[model samples]
Target: MKILQAPFTEEMMRSLRVGDEVAINGVVYTGRDAVHKYLHEGGELPPGVNLRDGIIYHCGPVVMKEANGDWKVTAAGPTTSIREEPYQGQIIRDFGVRGVIGKGGMGDRTLAACAAHGCVYLHAIGGAAQVLAECVKRVRNVYLLEKFGSPEAIWELEVENFPAVVTMDSHGGSLHAEVLRHSQAALAERV
Candidate 1:
């Protein structure tokens, strides 16, 4: 329910079944697209940085300056997960990241990796960026600025009660696949 880091045990991940709503507390990293490519391509993360046993967030926030000109998140929703399909599984294994937060669903390869690695994929609500931003206490820091542009930069966030649902579990259960199968079968009956 409340965790600061990943590399969580298999029992912890399994206890959190697909569709179990959760509120996360503590630190997390934001990364997507270009970051994934760079990591998989053997480009080392800047020195002193390690994602091992951390949670990676698939998000690109809309940030704004406060009255004092300090940047604050305006909209901070999860990104479509399918884009990372190409690199996710390998990244997870290579980097030792134990959790991923994104919108929508990942593919079979990612699901398989989760099973192999005792990881979990969490899905945050798609259109609730502003609301989610409210939960972010502060933008602790950022990284990977040059290649990925600002959007692809990694944001270190401090959060409290940040809402999400478990969509994929370490046991090889996938809420996304289950939902799709049910939808397809229902459509077939109508046709």
Candidate 2:
């Protein structure tokens, strides 16, 4: 397993191949459907918050505040990525975000956007809440708390050895589509 520290370059993103195990360390922010909508509607992010060259995780964590008023994520997992396909590509390009972390897979438009914008889609394992949380060493900050509920809040986390796979790459390579094609072909033989 290769441990990758972030501020990942475009070359690094393009170099990742399917089946290559990797751990990512750095700041990753959680954003979901509602957040995307807000952003699309020209909603302003918190002061000094920049999406450019950052990683956006499609998640809505189950969090609780500590006695000292510090927030802690009880459960953090990737949400279904396909739900954001319509806005994802545009968002990525507009924000200049270099990487995206989510579950399931994105579609052709997103793939094209990745290729055009020099980005990659990282796939986190589904249902691995506790396991993923172990990678989150700290919650650096958060935003959009009251307006969009927990789902839309962007929690910035400092991660260490966060495991994920490169499912969609900037070169127009898509593991999900390839797997689907192979499965269809294999099933055709049986029929």
TM-score of each: 0.91, 0.94
Model 2 clash pairs are none
Which pairs of residues clash in candidate 1, taking residues 3 or more apart in a chain or in different chains? none
> What lDDT does the true structure give each of the candidates?
0.83, 0.86
List ranges where model 2 is wrong by over 4 Å.
none
Per-residue alpha-carbon lDDT of model 2 for 1-191, expressed as tens digits?
A: 76667777777777776666778988999999988888878877788567877889999988888999988887888999999988998898898888899999899999999999988899999889999987888888888888778867888988898899989889888999999999999999999
- lDDT: worst 10-residue window of model 1: 1-10
Predicted model with the maximum lDDT = 2
User: In model 1, what lDDT does residue 24 have?
Assistant: 79
35 Cα displacement, candidate 2 (Å): 1.0
Q: Write the per-residue lDDT of candidate 1 for residues 1-191, one digit (tens) a residue.
A: 54423335456665777878878776788898888888888988776456776788899988666898666877899999999999999988988777899999899999999988878898999989988999898977777766677788888887778888999988889999999999999999998
